[model samples]
Target: MQYINFLPCEWNNDHGFTQEIFAIAIKNNIGIGNPDTVPYRKSQMKNSYQFLHKYKADINTITIAVQEPDYTYTNPKTSKKFTQAELYDFDKNYIGANIIFWNIQQPQFDSVLKFFANN
Candidate 1:
């Protein structure tokens, strides 16, 4: 199944004007929640893991992934490009924070494993 970011902007061009079209697209495709919305994506991850644990044991894996945006903001009027380093510093703390968050969410990952082990 194809996957798309659940962005309202994309729905207009790809799924038509109405939300019914958007819902149809979601039903047809593998609609991963938007990365920009952390809580929504996190919930999606939990639900997906649970589903995989129940039905797709071979494919289920604990994935603690973090994706920083590829491009920095560019000034449209000035035609100036801002490098990632210039926009935001990538440092140890950034890595540490994600690690901490991943650790905090380990129980959810563990549940998937426990489900598999029991069955």
Candidate 2:
């Protein structure tokens, strides 16, 4: 089974935990996720893509999750209790090499394993 560590872009600048996760993945020969890169605008996406691509990792194993902009549900009357569908449409439109949806609630671990097992 392949394991891809999901790393948010916000944590890229602060590589404390991110680096640790990356190190573990590298040591184990697992994959890594670059979700933050997909959210970048046109100009920024290029650099983000470059940075991730330079890792020389297996692109097919990478995953990216994008949240929807209007994915919010508040209480009917009170301003309490709410949930948002963090996976956005753009998240599904990533053209990066081997990018797949890494839904926050439903990660691809089980599905990916099942796919490979079935194959």
Candidate 3:
């Protein structure tokens, strides 16, 4: 199955419907955790991990954003250059890394690394 976005059109603070949809998608083998959203909303993040653990989503296929490159990207195919804001938007909407392979920067990722090294 392909990827699915569980973020609802209406963010009315109700997540029950979205949760059900995610369950269905997981049951059908849809890839989870790709294309994380902007601002990385806390609710979405929580739900994604919960479902990922609950459904035992394939660990190898899962992805998460690792870094915030401070540069513009030129599309090789069309030769169209993307502004930094556009790049950030794309990263938030389309790019990701596996939990194990996420190329994140300091602080948050530092904590994760430290925890693993200590334990």
Best by lDDT: 3
The whole-model lDDT of each prediction reads 0.30, 0.41, 0.45
**Model 3, span 1-119: residue lDDT tens:** 33444555534226575567666665665555544433333454454544544454333354444344322335444466533344344443333323423336654456546645765
Which parts of model 2 are misplaced by more than 4 Å?
1-15, 34-38, 41-51, 56-60, 70-97, 102-119
Better of 1 and 3 by lDDT: 3
Candidate 1 C-alpha error for residue 39, in Å = 13
How much is 51 displaced in model 3, in angstroms? 2.3
| TM-score of model 1 (CA atoms) | 0.22
Off by over 4 Å in 1: 10-104
lDDT of 2 by residue, 1-119 (tens): 23333335533335555445545665776755644423334333443343344454533355554333212333344454222221232333343335555334443345434544765
Lowest-scoring 10 consecutive residues by lDDT in candidate 3?
92-101
Candidate 3 local lDDT, residue 63? 48
For each candidate, what TM-score against the reference? 0.22, 0.35, 0.37
Compared with the true structure, what per-residue lDDT tens digits does model 1 show for residues 1-119? Answer: 21223434533234443344334544554332222212222343343322322322222121222233223234344455433232222211221112111112443446434543765
- Pairs that clash in candidate 1: none
- Candidate 3: residue 64 Cα off by (Å): 2.3
